[model samples]
Target: GNLNERKFLSTLVKENEVIVDMFAGIGYFSLPIAKHSKPKIIYSIELNLESFKFLTENIKINRLDNIIIPINGDSKTEVIKLSKSGVRAQLSFLVLY
Candidate 1:
């Protein structure tokens, strides 16, 4: 991951904004945003179970469990489920690399 990109992305997050990370990947982007951006909540979705596990652990280690919700499943499917459940995000990050 690029440190500059992560820092830039974090700065874009406004206070009380809701964020959805399509490929959380152990909370790479999610962690920074949660820790510095002051978002109200972040739904961090990861398809890989191993990555998801680390994502949860990272959230705990960062003491951001209250701000980041780690989900283990396909991002698209999980996002649809979240929408149906009335979870709306002000910003959604989908990184492809």
Candidate 2:
């Protein structure tokens, strides 16, 4: 379907890279990216409660708990906290989808 872009982007992620996925909807792109790329850490921020719930469930189902961190709230505020959390790794990408 619409996985071409996601598939391509996943190839760009390197080891120990950090990612901040804004507007992550039910781990659609994030899951594929995480599964394929295996970044050091990914902060997936979702605003919709239902979607956020699914996001967490998906992460768990995929056993990516140590890699993908699910944030249930507005990306606008959560991004700031993540940026200030002393995550010293270089950001590999900011997935806006």
Candidate 3:
């Protein structure tokens, strides 16, 4: 069985706070954050095209289009670009699987 970290992470999020998820595979963690935390915005970057596609679809399926912005690229580069573009997040987390 997979360890469910949803409750812990969800509790860490604050309303109107911004979040950056470096490896949001299939929205596994992002979905819970967006849906449960109700953050102002979440920048979810997934490098793998297949995973990115699922991330995008899951956002719609969960009705989190406005909250989660999916970026299909390497998380490192995307995060650099986001910073250059002035997108800031209150919290950032990286997941490796």
Candidate 4:
């Protein structure tokens, strides 16, 4: 995603809102959103182990561990599990492609 788009998206996030990024590769969108937006929590799901690793590291590096929960697995399956577990988000970013 473009930097401007990320910034714009961040602004759309309301304080204390819960967000879910279905394809949070290396926290591309998650990072900025977690940083600029005061969301209560962000469930970032990534399938690639390598990308997931970077996502976790980025969360720590950005000091957003509390707000961003990095999950390593297929987003489709993970999302189903999350829903069953009663994890709800006010906004969900499902960027395909």
TM-score of each: 0.96, 0.86, 0.92, 0.94
CA lDDT of every candidate: 0.93, 0.82, 0.88, 0.92
Which lDDT tens digits does candidate 4 get at residues 19-91?
A: 9998899999999999898999999999999999999999999899989999999988998999999988899
Show model 1 residue runs off by greater than 4 Å: none
Worst 10 residues of 4 by lDDT: 88-97
Give candidate 4's whole-model lDDT.
Answer: 0.92
User: Any idea what lDDT model 2 has?
Assistant: 0.82
**CA lDDT of 22 in candidate 4?**
88
Clashes of 4: 0
lDDT of 1 by residue, 1-97 (tens): 6999999999999999999999899999999999879999999999999999999999999999999999999998999999999988999998877
For model 1 the local lDDT of residue 70 reads: 93
Q: Which candidate would rank higher by lDDT, 1 or 2? A: 1
Best by TM-score: 1
User: Cα deviation in Å at residue 64, candidate 2?
Assistant: 1.0
The Cα RMSD in angstroms, rounded to one decimal, for candidate 4 relative to the true structure is 1.1
Order the candidates by TM-score, highest first: 1, 4, 3, 2
lDDT of 2 by residue, 1-97 (tens): 4799879878878877888888887987779888998688888889999999999999999999999999898878887787798755455344543
Candidate 1 residue 72 C-alpha distance from true site, Å: 0.4
Candidate 4 regions off by >4 Å?
Answer: none
